[model samples]
Target chain A: MRGPDAHGRFGPFGGRYVPETLMNALIDLEQAFRQCIDDQSFQEDLHTLLEEYAGRPTSLHEASRLSDALGGARIWLKREDLLHTGAHKINNALGQGLLARRMGKRAIIAETGAGQHGVASATVAALLGLTCHVYMGEEDMRRQQLNVFRMQLLGAHVVPVTSGTRTLKDAGNEALRQWVAQVEHTAYMLGSAVGPHPYPMIVRAFQRIIGKETRQQFLARCNTLPDVLVACVGGGSNAIGFFDAFVDDASVQLIGVEAAGSGLDTDAHAATVSKGTPGVFQGSLSLVLQDRHGQVLPAHSISAGLDYPGIGPEHAYLHHINRAQYVAVTDDEAMHAVEVLARHEGIIAALETAHAVAYVLKCAPRMPRDAHIVLCVSGRGDKDVSTMMAYKEAHA
Target chain B: MNALHTTFAALRKQGTVACIPFVTVGDPDLEVTRALLPALAAAGAHVIELGVPYSDPLADGPVIQRATARALAHGTTIGDVLQLAQDTRIDGLDVPLVLFSYINPIMQYGINALIADAARSGISGLIVPDLPYEEAQDVRATARDHGIALIPLVAPTSHARIASIVAHADGFVYCVSSLGVTGERASFASEGFALIETVASLTDVPVCVGFGISAPEHVAQFSRCCDGIIVGSALVRTIEQHSEALLDRSRRVQATRDVAHFLRTLFSQSSGGAQ
Candidate 1:
């Protein structure tokens, strides 16, 4: 991938696009980030927290039956799903929330769609003794009521946003507005590798530990980088974590799978990277699905997490630099992969991760024997079972 | 003459009763922005504050927040406002264009880049609400280098801070009429007149009171104390509420002319000392 500057500009994609009210906060964050990343005390603190508080070093398990079924490549799953909050989101949230406490911020605001990020933020807020406010789209609040209740139980005020398209985008917009107003005493804990400038860069730095550990583990086991790295793309946090370490490795191919509900030819899909054009949205230049008049179009997918009109700006830069390739997997294919993995390995994966599994299944068969591939098992499927059951009932 | 200085000089010559109107660029549409500016100029607006739409406008109340959202939804940017200023110049409008924005957009568009663009676009001045005097020196210097004025604000709360602000202020002192965000209040605070007098006593430059000076009576009161009265939220609220009617050609012209007539009445009455 092209080198992003300290200001988070990756080939004209990422930069600060927020209001002036947040400038001081951004400057403070930038300084804190530079100091904390290299400080030994900060590293030791984070290490202790990860080990004792967050349950770090999750297993890298080989799926033997799935590997045999796939016919050519050996597949291993890095199980981030088994983390405390059932996803990789907790890692970055816990890190940032701790830093917010260090900065003496009394409140935290976060935006979530499928509620994973909100739950993680709530978890950190409760642990750190800070008041937390989470903005979720009205539609997502109805769809992901369980996670919403989970956040409320953790003492976070779950605000339902009804503006714009009433989805993740609106929640993000509202969260930004709130941050701009209360930047003095509040910290906006962004969920993914998106948003303007320092957020995208800082968040990636926090999540890079995932790739660092996985790289060491893989090297110890197999003696080299895998031939291919696969991960699903929502706002592409998991994919970025898995891909960042190998960006300069020409021998390793990085592939990001997007949710293609039904088909790309159909209007019902969230294949933004696969079928999108570059435009400015949510404080960065990225691939967004828009009409002829430049009005952003609402994206659709069975996985609520992947149903966004734009990908992260860094992913857009990666695509532009040809360091990564993005492809779309249909809902039917992802669901089939979910069942196949469950029946074969007794592991039910989140639908977002199943998109990556489906791509691996499609591409693995054509690869040479002895090709090694690592897939990011991003989240547990407990939250998605109801949607999966409904899809099964309709199709059966 | 520099646009901001020219505006202040005009207000001083016109008996300390200048009328300043504010509008968000691309609120209803870009075309409305194009039409309303020249109309405000023709209708006795000595200085015009063109607001650049930001995603989060913390200091604005609901009316301007809604207007900002509308403008952002249309994909408005700082570049769009600069282009609008340039287009207005092509139409032969020579009024002082004071860009009223928060500092984030300018920083995002780089300080030097914005200053150069403002100069090329024929913009005369800038007012950044959140940019206090301490952080404003660099931007003010850049503006000065380009021959544009950086009009700094002096709030009532900033009592001891007024000297430094006035010393650095180039165009005029934007004396915030109240402590709160921009909106219309039922009555002008007696403290507002006091603050205006304090700022006027300290600065040789003209003082314009803003941020809740909406009604004719407020204008008259401000005219008695300050050099100019800037009416923002009230005028923005009227345009936002009447934007649909403005789609009709006759209604658009008539509505603008009606507002102009109202402003003229306020200016004349304020000058006449007939509250």
Candidate 2:
């Protein structure tokens, strides 16, 4: 009930629906993950790397100015943006990179949307001296050119995917294809808590450091648990990591904010939980934005990371069972949150993270003045400076 | 016996390997696909695999992906392809038809309803590349109830899994020729032959080699061991090459003939006489 069952189903939302060729590999991966997690040396190495290399125990800072500006709940920010790759994605990337190395794979392949994961994977590959290939959508490469260059600069070959709306979904398909072609020597370093079995569980486990540290830090600093926990849900990596530790606590409210590109009323939103149906997508059964005939619909968002048609299956399961609540925030609202965070807290939060902040901005003022809310600022928004400037010019 | 079982049984009795040709329905539109089915049968296809164009086809390479894009561009769906099957059956087509699809479209169509309709539409078998043996229980059970063969695929990596995967395999065991998506490979390693031998050792069902089988030599090579050979991307590539001709009213017949001619040459090289 906390994680997936033995067969990897979070109820009916997650299962291994992949080609026969990948089945044995998945089995091997699951076994390796189980072994590695239990091994003390593996955990020690991971802990050392997190502390020394990638910077662990990311600070949970209470934003007094931002909280006072909101005038209701006192807001805390989980500072995932301060990690080595400027995002929480490094947690899973490093974990998977180590797993791949332990599996005797010399090369790693990954799919990226906004390119934060690509950069994280590339950085890990560079540090570990493994060959890396990052499959990115052509459109994403264009929009996130800075991160694209960062991946390339890290010695990762960036392959542009031009199929299927020229976005993250197509990048995923291309990565799977290439992984199939060279699965013998390569390991797929999946970016998020999506994909087939063991992946959601694995990513959540790797990223649980976030929630673990946050819980300890918040309780130590405030002498009590936060009343509310919020994180943006793009494949639900950071959000899942942040929520897993508190899933059993009935007193804490967990909210996942989805990207509403224009609005949920329009056809152009990436709000999967807001407007999606159960379908198999990218190796897992989850809530997907697809046509009536099951063709995946193109998702749109100012933030490339959130522009995905499918949500992570665990999040779908959580939503289905009413363990968590999911809400949507529009691009404009997210952009406004970006500006507010920058002005009030000197934090340039990623657009994906801004969705969470935007939702808190709307709801915090209505909560009790003593209520506490922890928001996951999942990534830095330096990559979005250009997009932000362009948006401002257009609006002006 | 079902059409798939009957076709494979007859092929084994005749001491010849079956030739299975795959095409994406609604590529260059549905009418050409309709014409290609019977044409492929005439060109000695023992069974035909109809690929449903999906939005995301992870098991396919660029060639079939392009075919899918073309097919989906025209708004092709599982319903439309099944309708095509019904129409072709009405046109007196006798070759066994296997619907090769990714699992999403079928899940969207509602599994029970799709299987019943597929049975009614003369679809002989189902091949969902994404549905491995473990997750295929409900789909397999439904297809079994409807008397449709849910063909299973085995790869070199399938190793000890081959037996359990083929435990309830109906129709033929689809043996992936290599460890990759569907496309043409310059040469195949002996791993394919070993995998096929292992699969044959496990199941009584006929084993067919597919994935990366492009030329006649590949078919001839695989025909020596397997009960059949499946040609997907190669034949779909042929359709792609003739897409301009297929879309033209005046050149459509010639293009269809050319495709049949290509299949004939490919089949002609196969020493197996069953097809």
Candidate 3:
């Protein structure tokens, strides 16, 4: 059946590998989450927030021009970019924010790389009137100053993490450290399907709205499920959410795209599923880009959102069981897809989302003309315009 | 009994509190780590916890975190640390060696190989902060097979679960002095002592309190309730302060002596100062 049994294991991955100080808190969180799942008021509150606040049921649009350009399968876009926060991150943020309020936590803390999750968490904290602290790597803060400022404008204190690579991995370490120190009154609003037990399960549950809506919309429009689903994998939150509803469907091929910065032969990349090995990272056993000494290596990517060394333990499980296929696309390919999408569909996609689009551009042409493929556009590209321009200037 | 248990037993018999000092191996370099071990032993450390530098040390605060970074920057690995331990013992450092590490490095080294090597190197115990009670059964069993004590850490948050957490615990129970990562703190949590007391009540093994313990006052306070006191971040910070002197070939001996002096003064206030 669906994994992560009582001990939070999927085969051999996913467990609470945190310090003893957070064990009781995790157990209580798990209990509270289980109760919230069955509580009618909690469900209604979450649904109402998702619908009235975050804007649910994001449209599934037919990308006929892009489809014809690829010249094989019809391409459909799950428009999570249309969400209020300009990303699918709002769904989990609102859900977890409600949970934190229910748990009577006075404050919320989170870590971010590309800063979409930080902004979304700050938005929720502002909506719920909770004090929020967002830990961001110094480098990410430099790269995503706009999102960082957006979080500050939403009334969240942004703490810069300067330890170990000064990126998402270090940001996560710093956040967890803060959470441990402040577990009494704080709820760590983990933004992805990584970390310890119950988090992967919790985030997946909150984000499953993507797959749920896509299923109903696809059936209503096409009268059949799409042949394949594609989404980029950082910590695999959006991909896991997009794949949840179709996991049991034997014919629905699940494809997760990982960022291969430069190339896999080089040291710079975030292709955890493709190049990583099983190891404990950020409180869970997962596919991690680490040295032979088991020290986590820094991951590089054009997309700050996808520059992470660890994959979600659930994604690692899915890969292990052969239920899903993972592929890597270089920064150049993703950049090319960004241009192609903007030209063909008049849509600007985040660099992270372009990884999925890059994969679709490659595989859609190989499939039958009648076959349909759905790609998750996880975020808008407003946050990446400056980065793109800089890259262009450097390359030119 | 193993070296850890025997050491604790002897300290219990003598009515003296066990003083454990932690140092990150190869912080400046392995030569300094080798020189510091005997100094710590001479400074009245009953057992020394040698920290293996890891890229991601989540359970550590800024002090030890920086220490690990420095150690890793010098290219320190688990193998180097274990080799250092063996080398120091060959030079006649009699204190039991307890390895403090994250779980990933141990996994990379291979669990069976690690236990075997640790046993061969005369390592008495292991304290993997990330390997909590829930997922430690297999590792506990493996360490047991090799006569290595896989020390378990219990925190103030581990209420009602303390018994099961330390049921078959071997060397000692590491009681975290507060609800945070390792660093010196002005004061510990209100429930910290009660948690230690609760663990002492449940386990036959000696209970040692660590985390946020730096000052002699913290050592004296925890010594009243627990069998031993472990100072990590504070000690690591001391080594860091003297890292330049330690790295200097001519000044290394003085640096080691200074670190030992710091540990000595901290533990000198332990258990009514009978020592």
Candidate 4:
């Protein structure tokens, strides 16, 4: 309902906090985006690609059996898992890919934590015939090897980042560093609704299709907006995408679930909003996992995608303004929910999405039977098979 | 005048280009940093840049990143780095100390508090590599109030941005010669030389170039282009090769000698006044 002001600020949050070298580049991007974003031809071309190539308008299904098992709120699943590249990451990747071609950049660069974003970027790069390079943490690359191979097959040079925490944060840092040097000829295809100004706004605009579609589809199916919108928050793109259209609906509640890797009581967690302080990081002002001296702490999660130490600035703004309520779900809780969804709903959600399912399991029982909840299934759990196997092996 | 201004003014009068060396504080340990600062200063570092180790140094390359990791591994905080600078000052090291960091640590420390503590710690100025001048007004004002110069960075920039940076530049303007992040490179771009020229033409303050000047020849070549030269990753890489053990006092001593010798070599080869 409400967008960031002219400064790309959602209140005191988003701004282009970067090196002087990248300031002009960011300005150029902002100007380019501002000009072409509303142009009919640009939107048409982007829409055509989204529909023809990337598979837009993913289905909305009612999880009746899972709803029956939960025995309370009716559950509607917005299947972003069906998007090309098996995750909603392609939405932004494709959008940025088109923008990159429009800007006449020769190559595309991106940072990946879950590997989904990298895969999506690579997929788009291959489709559009742009050379792509992706920076992924060594740990994430090892765990998400399937996606890595997929990226390699798609002709992207995946650079393994071994610096910092060796996760999303480090990959992001490496990408930004690479972008600083190659700004004239490369487009940094940022994956999430995080980072500096314009990026958060641009990503949200591309992803807002989820909310826009959900509104139309749900109205046709259920005849009304759901009582609640629930989505996992790892840099908060899917949640922002899901929440943006319904943000003005006072009756609709937006719930963002953070990944609690072990538990919030322990050090191993990515529950940034729950445990972090406000600081400037990764080109934006957001709630970050940092120590007393503001050195960003490494975040952990079972899902590589949800292991980022920082959330998007708009999510922080929303949390600050009480527009949304944030909750933390432990890895164990999420895994159990993943199993429950598999057994009851015949759906295996990505561990990142399982966090929301886990939260719904906890909250649904308390809600009225008539109350409706829509869980944004941001991605399918195909990539998490190895993690599942490891969990199985360890527990066995 | 402040220590930074005084140092630059005196260096100008001496017709000598400043040899500024950067090292991550608490890189090996606080003791190593303490001894290293003075050694670098004594070896002809006109101004010493002490890096505040950040987990995510976006502008930094592998060399500095490894140094920061080593520093953080030993639980080195900004407070500890400030303590080291203060201790070195107490031990009669008179080099103008510039605390170089990303903005997060200073923001966490509270900008006003950091400026006050920096001044008390005998720190002369600050250089946040990622902090552009547009978002730096408040910190610059407070730093000025605290007698600490908030040094503005001039990357390889366009003419308009260069004008904006020079018009408001305090202390000395740090001109990054390389197109990329901090590291030693084999060669320089013609644009880098042009950037130094552009900055020098517009600014009264000393213009120092950093981001990839390693060898003594590089120092001599760059010294001819600007008022000063900052050696970062190459200098850190030198100590890293000798003192891998971080806590080994003898190894640290050897590394400190190597750095001092490195700076001495660079300065001895430097011919004269800024080009």
Clashes of 4: 0
Candidate 2 per-residue lDDT over residues A228-276, each given as its tens digit: 9999997999999999889989899999999999999999899999999
Per-chain TM-score of chain A in candidate 2 equals 0.99
**Recovered native contacts in candidate 1, as a fraction?**
0.03
- What DockQ score does model 2 reach against the true complex? 0.90
Clashing pairs in 1: none
CA error at residue B195 for candidate 4, angstroms: 0.7
- Model 1 per-residue lDDT tens digits across residues A1-396: 454676568886776544334545776887787788888888888888777888888788888899998798999898999888888898889888878877889899999988899999999999989999999999888777889999999999999987666788778877877776466789999998887767777778878777888888899999988999999998889888888888888999999999998899998889988888776566665787765334467888788788888888999999988889999999999999999989999999998899999999998888877989999998888888778888999999
Question: Which residue segments of model 4 deviate by more than 4 Å?
Answer: B244-247, B250-254, B273-275
Question: lDDT per residue, candidate 3, A1-396, as tens digits?
Answer: 897899998889999899888988899999999999899999999999988988888999999999999899999999999999899999999989989999999899999999999999999999999999999999999999999999999999999999987889999999999999989899999999999998999999999999999999999999999999999999999999999999999899999999999989999999999999999999999999999999999999999999999999999999999999999999999999999999999999999999999999999999999999999999999999999999889988
Docking class of 2: high
Q: Write the per-residue lDDT of candidate 2 for residues B195-257, one digit (tens) a residue.
A: 999999888999999998888788889889989999888899999999999889899888998
- Clash pairs of candidate 3? none
lDDT of 1: 0.82
Give candidate 4's error at residue A106 in angstroms. Answer: 0.9
Please say which candidate is ahead in DockQ: 2 or 3.
Answer: 2
Tens digits of per-residue lDDT for model 3, B1-275: 69998888888988888988899999878888899999888888899999999988889999998888888987899999899988998899998999888999999999889889988999999999999888988789889999999999888878887888899688999988888888999887668899888898888899998888878888888888888899898999999999999999899999999999999999777884424
> Per-prediction DockQ, in order?
0.13, 0.90, 0.89, 0.75
**Cα shift from native, residue A21, model 3 (Å):** 0.7
Per-residue lDDT value at B95 in model 2 = 92
- Candidates in order have lDDT scores of 0.82, 0.92, 0.92, 0.89
